[model samples]
Target chain A: MSNTPNRNRQLRSKLGRVRGLGSSHEGVHHWWAQRMSAMALLPLSLWFIFSLISLTGSDYVAFQSWVSEFGNSVFLVLFLVSMFHHAQLGLQVVIEDYVHSELWKMGLLLIVKYGSVLFAASGIFAVLKISLAG
Target chain B: MAEDDRPLSPHLQVYRPQITSVLSITHRATGVFLSLAAVMLTYWLASAAYGPDSFARAQAALESWFGRLILFGFTFSLFFHMCNGIRHLGWDLGWGFDLVKLRMTGVLVIISAFGLTVLSWVMAYSHVGKL
Candidate 1:
């Protein structure tokens, strides 16, 4: 209705006035993801530390048997991928702030994002294969 | 774009050295190093998944002198970065901003990094029966 149109206009104008303000939606979510992933890693990393200590003298079969467990491998894969995502985002911020050249900054960020995702996926695929084969 | 007319910001090259400055730079450098290590970890995982032969090859490399050195450095870097990152997080939460507290935390981070690295390796080595 005509009244709805007026309300929409009012809202648009209000938002427009705030449009050029300092912050963007990007930074908040990125910061949160970094923090969340770091928090997640706290427990997982502790688990991994203990597991690695246990695996220290483990023969090949023993290590494989451990990783072959569905829950452990899945969680380990999750940890690795999330860690990569968080690390990539953190590194992107570092690069953008430190690298003076705009072109290089953009290029490096793209490389980091794609490279991290690729490596994470490949690692996960490898884990899946190893676990399934066992 | 004007060569001489544009305002320029100061940089590290203009500043004298200090321990804090050095540590700050090393923190970033080690972060970059950790990124590289993550890539290697992915490779190691992929190889382990491939087969026993692949895992053996990866293990052999890790057992070599060069690999051991890299692993040692990475362990130290990991501990240092973890400690320093916690220090930063504490500051972010508004807890250690005073100069004295900042300096004390910085020293504490270094010592803790060393202590943690030693403890981890001792545990790892003992488990492997190589201690």
Candidate 2:
């Protein structure tokens, strides 16, 4: 058993050897998630901008009616979810890079992670409330 | 701590600002700004859900001069981040790595971001018949 493990380690590439030893064991996941969310946000963000333009000078009722529509509500929720996910991941990288002290880094990371979830939940709830109630 | 004083690889302080480097950092800075902006977005949605009175207050606050200024900044930052993000995606696909192409794309990203921001604001103001 020991020899087999040693053989496997020897066969690993230089980069592979240290793959999961870093803080986040899931390698490339953060990078991949960021890119995927970015792609999703491209169309969703465009939709949001145009929608806001159309809603220009409109009152609360106009905005509410827009959100109450099924497609609009769905897209709004999707936009919020992806936006927060991307924001959290991007902010995590920024924090990790600049915040040298492990304590501060971890503290900010926790705040961002939790704050994103909380904000996302609130946004989604609001959308659902308008869509269903109105 | 003494070991930290040892010479390290070239970092931000050592390099004269170049287009590629400047844009790269700007991408990060805009991204952070947008993250903060998401709070306002949530506030808008939540206020709308709360009630008509709350929504009116929210709209009034956002439509103020200061609010418009912030919104304009948010708009530019968002478009800049989006345009540059596309450039980054292209690089990830192993395209546009040549020095000339890199500079070209960097410039293109800036122009496109500015253009889109201007276009969106124009559409917005035109829609409301006030600019």
| TM-score, per-candidate, Cα-based | 0.84, 0.90
- Residue lDDT tens for model 1, A12-99: 3445456632244343567668777767766676677667777876666886888899888988798788768867977887887677
Off by over 4 Å in 2: A1-24, B1-11
lDDT per residue (tens digit) for residues B1-131 in model 1: 86445554447787897667767877878778878777877887787887778888888897799987887788788778777877777876899888888888889988998898788889999988898
lDDT of 2 at B43: 96
TM-score of chain B of each: 0.89, 0.90
Name the runs in model 1 displaced over 4 angstroms.
A1-25, B1-10
DockQ of all models, two decimals each: 0.42, 0.69
Tens-place lDDT digits, model 2, residues A41-108 = 99999999999899999987788899999999999999999999999999998897787676898999
Assess each prediction's global lDDT (C-alpha) against the native. 0.78, 0.91
C-alpha displacement of A3 in model 2, angstroms?
A: 20
Lowest summed lDDT window (length 10), candidate 1 chain A? A19-28
The local distance difference test score of model 1 is: 0.78
